[model samples]
Each structure stands twice: as C-alpha cells, then as structure tokens.
Target: MSEQAPLVSVIVPNYNYAASLELCLRALQAQTYAPIELLVVDDHSTDDSVAVARRLGVRVVQTERNMGVAGARNLGVAHAGGEILVFVDSDVAAYPDAVEVAVAMLAADPRLGAVSSIHDPEPLIRDSLVEDYRALQYYYWTASSEGSISFLFPALVAMPRRVYDEIGPFNTQLRETEEVDYGHRLTQRYDMVLTSAVRSRHDHDDRLGKLLRKLYRRGRARVPLYAQRRRFACGFETSSRAGGSLAALAALAALPVAAPLGPAGAMLPAAALAVSIIADLGMYRFVLRRRGPLFLLYFGVVHFVVNVTIAAGVAAGVVRWLFSARFRRLYEPDLHVRPSAAGEAAT
Candidate 1:
C-alpha cells in the first residue's frame, strides 16, 4: 500500500477584498495537488468576504477585531490542520502547479524552510503607466536568481509545519512588513527560496494615487522595522536606490544657492543632478525600451514622487518611534524559537 500524501492547508487572510476573494479561492481549488484544506481568516471585514468563503465550502475564521495581515495569519495558523501550511493572499491567483512545485521543493530539501512563487502581475497590468511600471517591477523581481531569499511574501508561500512551529507565529504587533521580519527569523536557521518555476498573479494596485499611498505605508513600516533591528538582508538594493534619489534631490535643492556663487559652483550641482538622472535612466533603460519614449515622460515624475513620499513616511516613522511608547513596545526582540523548544514545538 502506498503512503498517503501530506495534507496542505491553504490559509488566506482577508480584509475588505470581496471582489477578488472568489477568484483567489477558485484558483486554490483548482490546484493539481490533493489533500488540501482551505482556511479563510477574515480580519473583521465589513464586506461579504466571510459569506463568499462559506459559499465555497471553506472553513471561515473571523477575528473579533481588525488585527491586520500578520495577526490574521497567526490566527489562521493556530487553527490550521495540515502538515504543510501554505499562505495565499486574497488578491493572488495561484497557478495550478504552484502548490505542487513548492511542496516538492520543500520535500526535496529539508533545509528549505519556506518557498514563495514568482508573482506575475500581468493580469493586473493595464494601459496605465503606473500599472505598467508595477508589472515591470514584478517581472524584474521574479526574474531574480533562484536561491536563498531574504523573505517570502504571503502572496503565495509554502513551508513545512515544523518550520512554523520552530519559528513561532507571525508577530501580530507589526501592521506592515511583517513578512520581512518573519523571513529574517527563518533565514537565521534555514533557507527561504523564491522560484520562478511556480507562478501566481497578483491583483496589484494600479492607480497612481493608491500606489503612492501603499509605498508611503511601506516606508512608514520600515521605521519601526529598522528601529528594532541592527541589520536586515535584502535592504541593500532599496537603501542604495533611496540614497541615490536623496543625493540627487539635494543637488537640485542646492542649485539656487550654488548659482549665486558662480558658474563653477552652479555647474557642480548641475553635474550632480545630471549624473543622478543618467543613473536612474540607465537603471530603467529596459522599461524605456519596453514602453517607448512616452514612459520616459512619466518615469522621472513617478520616481521623484515615490522617493519623496517614502522619505516623508520614513521621517514620520522615525518621529513616532522616538516619541511613541506604543510604537517602541511593538518591536519583537526575537522571532525565532529557542533550540531546546524547537523539538518540543515541532512535535
């Protein structure tokens, strides 16, 4: 007699995303992998998300209050009944093979604590410039080398139940970027892989205003995340870009003062700004080639706006971290479970 396949529980945490809930669930139901359980943890959603989950014949766990994504995920894991836990966001549509691929990778390598699918935002990409930019960004991210990753976003991730038990639950206190924190903990002991073999489509925010707001929120989240930790992987790329953008902005701001000094002084700032622009354009040259010159018209403006908003958000986060006791208290000292407790917890 052949052994039965391990159960895989797909946990989805949602809040006010009724429009995409059905599609997300349907995609999971269509997975090639068998012995799967669906758990939808609603975070006090005002919409019809709970009803939709029930109609789909999935288990629905409603939080008493809004606990954010991290909290909702923790609750879902607590109630989950599977040897392998897979997290899928309400706005993500996983490919039929996504779970099978991830599970295979985890089974083949015990050191791999988690695996996340390469998110393709093609479906969400529209004619709008913002949407196009978002799509290209996802494409670039997904194309990255398949190896150990710093973190895995919940959009579509799978890991053995033992990994979760060892790592404990997602920190409920973090309102944003909790995945980064969780990844940091996971990576300390085991590998986290991001593979292009598995795929999923993300219903990304396309509107410029909404996209900017999301960036700002991410920026604000960084403050507390940075405050609590001395260092984090996968931040080098972002920090380098933000640093370059700020340097360019400073050069432009100083242009007026330099103008009063002389041609030489003014030329220095001009040269600095030009270098920044050239670097940015070089970095996004593929985008220009893909979308044509029209993309260039919006590229600079979008880059500047995004960087400025993120800077403002970071500034706000810093202020709050310094003054707000509540913010400081939310930081978790360690996300990893003790070695001695790991064996006990895993069992």
Candidate 2:
C-alpha cells in the first residue's frame, strides 16, 4: 500500500453466477496485494449473490433491475473509493500475485495507464484443441515487446484511477466489447500494458451452446467499432473472407432452382460445407484434443454454428452502420463523450 496513492479497489460484477463468484471472492480475500477493497455488484441476481458478498464482508451494490455486465461495472466504479480500479470477472480467480504484479507495473511506469493479467486457467471446453488454439492465438497477440496492449479483455484488467477520467467508463449501452472500445480510447491517450507476469485463471463451463452464443455476441458486438471507415474497411476485409465463405455456401444451396445446373449447384454447397468442416477440424484440433469422441462431434458442429453466426452478425452490423446513421453513432457510444460525472468516475 502506497501512502501517495489511495487503495486499490477490485470490482467483480456478477449476475446469476453464484458458484463461480464464490471462487472469485475467495481469491480476492487472499490476494497478496494488501490495502485493497472488494466491491461486488450484483445486477439483481436470482441467486444469493448479495448474501454471499455480505458473508465475505465485502461492500455489496445491488441494482433493482438486471443491468448487463457493463452497467454493473459502472455502478461498482461509481461506489468504489480506491485510487486504482481493477475489474475481475466473477468467473475468474486471480492468483495471489495478480494484484501485486499489476500494481508494480503501473507504479514503476507512471505513463502506463492500464494493465490486463494473463489468464491461465485449466481448459474445460470439450474441444481441447480449439481451446488451445484460442489460448495460443490470444497469447501471441498480447505478446508485445513493449509490455503495451492493443486491446483489453473484460475478464481481468487493472489501471490507475485517472484512466476513467481521461477516457470514460465502460459504455452502458454495450452488452459486450465495451472493454475493447475503452482499450482503443486508452491506447490513444496513455500506455496500455499487458503484463505477462500477472496471472488469473478463469473458472467456468463453456458448453457448446454457451460458446456459440458468446461468439455470436462477439461478432455482433464488433459492429460499432467497424463504423469508422478505416476500422470498418479493415474489419470487413477480414470478416468478409470468413463470412463470404458461408454466404457462398448459402448461394450455392440455391443452385437446385436452376434445372440445368441443379447437380452442379448442389456440388457448390457440398464443397462449401466440406471446406468449413475441414477448416474447423484443423482450427479446433488444438483445443478439442481432450474431449471424448462424442463431445468432439457435438463441439465441432457447435463451433461451426458459432463462427457462421458471428460472421453473419458482423455482416449485418456493417450493413447497419452504412444504412443507419443512428446505429453508426450509437454503435460506438464510447466515442461520443457525454457530459456526466458518472462517465467521469473511473478510467
């Protein structure tokens, strides 16, 4: 604890994640970093999340209605009294050294505005290969020599109190991708660090349906960020390749309507399906190795569905951006700074 800087507040946002939230709370109580206050914000959970927080003796904030993750986090930030704010998901458990490392990283470099800990969790998804691939790709992406991050994950992040002031709070309108939006703004103003030493482990189930939903939301959530011509153009260039493949398949599916090219058009759909299946096999093998055969078969199909749905959503988001000015403006709420102290609370 530094006398110069006020305490660090660790805020965990929860909604019907009682089981996972318990592990997270326990970990916070045992952090190596002292002088920290824990604030658990429950967005009107049906579970006894408030009771659990009370049992732990942490400050509890409750919303009358179910606000999404971003809104809950905003509420927590509003009530936090610490000079440094840390957001840890209810589904994750921070290692004892987690806060210690992040605090040191920010303290040593006055210019570094934010920090995200490495997530080192045991893989639970049935598809081990796909899980490994996702982890590896994320690892490589964040493995910058400068210790600076291009993006922030909501799972675990720490930063100085001044950050929220300059940039803004998590956009209340966003159900997801709020962290990424905030990260872009932070990078523009201050150094955003992805500390390799700080570690946290995510503890939760990633059932096939849940995974698909998450990816679908991710693909959909990226729409607003794509509104800027340069960002949108780059995004479309990549997203189109993924999405166009599926669109091509659907187009080929319509070929049976042509009497002359009936069988040939059918081949197009078959080819598209084959390519997508093979792609998933190769892409997900790294993460799905541990799952049993039955799980693998189901997860493989689920993965494809998720990818296709996300790609489609991205395409839709892009169209909305172009056709609707209101959507484009609202797509990136963090970009449009409104006059409010709530927005000014945490950085």
Candidate 3:
C-alpha cells in the first residue's frame, strides 16, 4: 500500500457459503491495503450468502444463473474498476496484509503475472476432523512448493488487469479446473508465485465424502488439460505425487486379485503400499513433526484413502479420454480460451 496506490478490487465468488461469508468479508474489510474494492458475486446461491454480504455493507452481484466459480469470477471482473484484481473465495478469510503483500509482489516484479496466497494449516472455523485433515494436507502441498510456480490458487490470489487481459478470462466450461487451465495459459509468458507473504485461512471440506468427491472430480476434470500440455502447475503436483496415488491404487486393485495367489501375491500389494508411502514420506514426516504421532497416524490413513480416490479418478478420466471424443476435447480450445461475458456461459 504505497503512496499513489492503485485500486485493488477483491472479487469473492460465492455459492452457498453463507456460513463463512461474513468471516471472509470482515477480513477483507480490515485489509491493510488502501483503495480496496470488495464485491461478492453470488452464483445463484440458495443460501443467505447474499444477505450476509449485504449486511456486511459489501456489494453483492448476483448472477443470472448458476455460472460456477469461473463464471462468477468473470462477472465480478466485469464490474470491477480496479487496476489490480484479487480473487478471494467466499470460504477464505484473508489476513490483513494479504492484499498489500500481493500488490507489492506484483509491483516488485513486472514479470509476475499472479501471486497466490498459501492457506494456513487450519480452517477459518474448526468444524470437523475431515476439515482439519484437508487444511493440513493442502497447506503442506502448497507450502512445500513456494516461490515461482505455474499453478494459480484463486482462493486468495491477485494479478494486474493487464496481465489478466493478456492471459484472458478463465474458461467457463472448466468449473472445477479453471485455475489449472488459467495457470497453464498464464505461465506460457509470465511467472506466477505461491507465497506465504500473502496468507489466508480457508474453510476446507468438512465431510469425508465431500472432500473425496471434490478431489475425485478435480483429478478427473484436469486430465484433458494435462493431456494437452502435460503441465505440472507446481512442484507439488510432481510425478512423485502422481506415483504415490498410482502406487496406492495399485495396492488396492491388486489386493483381491492377489488373494487367490496367496502369500507371494500378498507381497506385491505390500510393496506397492510401501512405495506409495515412500512417495510422500516427506509429507508424513511434516505432519508428524507438527501434529505429533496420533494425529499423524490418522492423517496417514486419511491421506492413503485420498490418494487411492485421486488415482481412481485419473484412471476413470483416462478411460473416458480413450472412449469419448468430447472428453478428449475438454481443453481443445486451450489456444484461445475465455470466459463468457459477465453473465452466462457462451451458448
């Protein structure tokens, strides 16, 4: 927030997150950055999210239909008048200096197209064990991949309007993997950074089923993009990480098949499991150091299940890619991708 500060519009894309909307906005209200513009773009939420945004004295832009997060964000951008744009999800409570730090990073480096904040290893509100596990897992994944990256975490990220225009709006079709698509497009010419300099606390999935389903869909949805560019958005999504999931999945799939072969076959799955564990042994040790043995044990069990689910999702995506032309063409428009104009998906 230097003198002659440019306007920073913080666009919050919301969908039925009223439970945490107030916290999100209140934190924005207290940002250390000046000349800040905050708007909550509600994507046809059935909950009282709009009311909460209004009560907080923030502008609420309601979408004509359920346009998903990408659409909502595009609409928010359309209404934004700031030189700098910040996208903070409704479920994230950004710290006071989040905007200031992001703006500084962008200003300090002309090559920096986007600066994404890393969330704390805790939720905005303590809800369930699943939430805690997710927060910790996501934090470690991001924290371990700090500095220049190809990934763009939109939950708490900022970029100049010109850079956004150059990269273009997020793909409306990529509701689940828009960030992935955007990151690939952005990284082609500019640098994107993931830093603790701009921090936020996110309200991660509270239910085990919800967490698993989200990851599964994200894993599946990202196949077309990866198939096209084969890009690893960040160091976090490395081959070793994929190997972990695949190894875990191999163990699961081989268990029953190997049961018929008895003792010798059992060794196959055991070795796969060991390889999977070894793949992310650093993550396990990180959790162990922070949460101690008991929580680390629980974290490992949950993470194993998560890895299996992600691998299964990717497997399903591969099968669909081989069979369905449409699935293969999911990111076919990567060369010239843009979001619909502020309101609806292109028809």
Candidate 4:
C-alpha cells in the first residue's frame, strides 16, 4: 500500500459466451483492485456478446475476422492503457479480490513474470453434470499444482507491461496451444506460478460432445509443442496423467479386437481400464471427497470417457504430425507485431 498502484488493464477475449458475459463483467467491475480499465474483444461472435458488453458500459472491440483468442488479446493490449495487463476469459467470473491479490503477488516478486489464477471447483453457472465434472477436474488439477508452474492458464492471468515487452505478444498462429508455447517461452526467462490466492470460477464445457471436441483439439494441437520440448510441461499435465488416458483408450480399443478370444481376451481391456483408473486414483479420490460417492461414480464414468477422448486426440495428432506438413507447423509463426486484432471495421 505504500507505493502507487499502477493502472491495471483487464482484457477479455471473447467468442460467443454471451450467456455468462454479464457475470464476468460484473465480477470484474467489482474487483477491489484500483485504477483498472476493462475492454472486451469480441471475436466475430454470432451472438449478443458485443451488445452485452456495450450494455454493461464497457469498451468493446470487434475483430475483422475470427482471428482466434491470441489475436483478440493482442488487440486488447494495443488498446489497453494500464501498466499491468490481466486476461480474463468471457466465461470466467473472477472473484472480487482476484485482481487485487494477483497484482499484489506480481508486485511482491520482481522475479515473477506472470501469475495464473486457480478456478473454484464449482462452475460460474450450474448448467450440467459435464460442466460440474470439468470444473472439479480442472480445480483439483490446478489446486494440486499451486506455485511455480510451467503451464499458463490463459483463462485468468496477469503480467506487467514490461514482461509483455520482453517476451513479445502471443504467437497468433497458435490457436489451440498458444498458452503452452507462451508459457514455455516465458519460464525460460522469468518465473510463472499458478496460485490459489488468485481465484476465479470458470463455466466450463457443459455438453459431452462439445467438451470432448475441445479436449480432443487441444490434446492433438499440443503434440507439436510437446514434440518440440520432447517432454510434457512441469505442471498439471504429467506423464502419469497422459499414461492414464492412454491406458483408458487402449482398453476401449481392445474391446472388439479381444472379443473373439472370449473372456480371456476381455482381460486385456479390463486390465487396461483398471490400470487407467489406478493411474489417476488421486483425482478420483479428490472427487469422492468433494462430491461424495454417488457423484464420484458418475465422475469416474464421465472421466473414463474423457480419458478415451484425450487419448484418441493425441493419437490423431501424432498421425497428422507424421504425415501432414501443415499439421507439424502448427506452432511455427513469426512473432512480429501485427495490425489491430480487428479488421478495418473495428470500432
């Protein structure tokens, strides 16, 4: 409290999240942090996102085309007037003190490059069991890895303007794994941490197909980044977790192949499933403690399906990487400054 608080700019890169934009903006507006400016970069949403932001009386910028989240965020930074930059996704409603706490953490540590917020186990808006499962899974996954992290949770993160200057803007070519590439670039120089002190509630994917597709794309897209690293990041996504998904997937795949062998062949899939479940035993236990036994059963079933989907995605990505030139070049983009995130019609 002794030094003057730097003006903080909160940038929201949105894509058709009108249902929860009000809550996101309201919670952001109520932040205890001082000297903050809010801007929403609508990514050609075919919804009322711009209208919602306008109704809430916040500055709105529309993209010329759907350039992806990274482009939108870059535009927000262009328009932002704060020394501190905060990125809050449209579906996430940050807690009242989220910004204040995050800023303090950034200021307290001169070596810290960025701070990523932890999400509550519950969703911002209760929609379905799938969302609930995602919220809890993400919450536990992140909460278990608080402090000194390599993965950047772009959903709710803060950084000083100087850090942005040094590291440069996000690689716009990285539509799915931009954060992963950015985090890798960032931690090589300065420290980035995932802390519980900065917390928010994210309205995660609520439908099974929608959730699986997103996870699958992210799973496949990240193969190139991991290929470059030759290893997974140091945080939540671990070798053990990847193994669990693979095991679950192998089990699902072995079902028909082993069916001709009768009960003896069933052992392969059953054993694989058991191994997969055991691999992530801690996550299931965390769910059990929080949601009780009944919900835990549902959680297990849903998670098994999710693991299979992730495994499939990674496999697909691997195949593409081997065969397709464009797929392998998913993360190779020039990191130079580009024009406004929006098209000429940007307002």
Better of 3 and 4 by lDDT: 4
Off by over 4 Å in 2: 1-6, 121-147, 232-285, 288-301, 332-347
Runs in model 4 lying further than 4 Å from the true structure: 1-3, 333-346
Using lDDT as the measure, which candidate wins? Answer: 4
Model 3 over residues 1-347: C-alpha lDDT tens digits? 46799999999999999999999999999998999988888898899998898888898888778988988888888889999999999999999999998998899999999999999998889899888899999998899999888878899999999998888888887878888888878998899999998989999989999989998998898788788786666756878899999999999989998899989989989999999999989889988998899999899899999999999889988888889998787787653466665454211
Alpha-carbon RMSD, each predicted model: 5.0, 5.2, 2.3, 1.7
What TM-score do all the candidates reach, one by one?
Answer: 0.85, 0.76, 0.96, 0.96
Better of 2 and 4 by lDDT: 4
Error of 4 at 191 (Å): 0.4
Per-residue alpha-carbon lDDT of model 1 for 99-137, expressed as tens digits?
988888898999989998777737532547677676765
Q: What is the lDDT of residue 201 in candidate 1?
A: 83
Task: State the lDDT of candidate 4 residue by residue for 1-347, as single tens digits.
Answer: 33588999999999999999999999999998888899999989999999999998999988778989988888888888999999999999999999999999888999999999999999999999999999999888898889898889999999999998788888787788888888888898999999988889998989999999999999999898888679898788989899999999999999999999998999999999999999888889999998899999999999999999999999999998999888776666454334344472446
Put down candidate 2 lDDT per residue, 196-305, tens digits, no spaces: 68887665444545655676667666777755634532111243345544654454454565446767656666666666665444434543555456656665554555
> Which is better, 2 or 3, measured by TM-score?
3
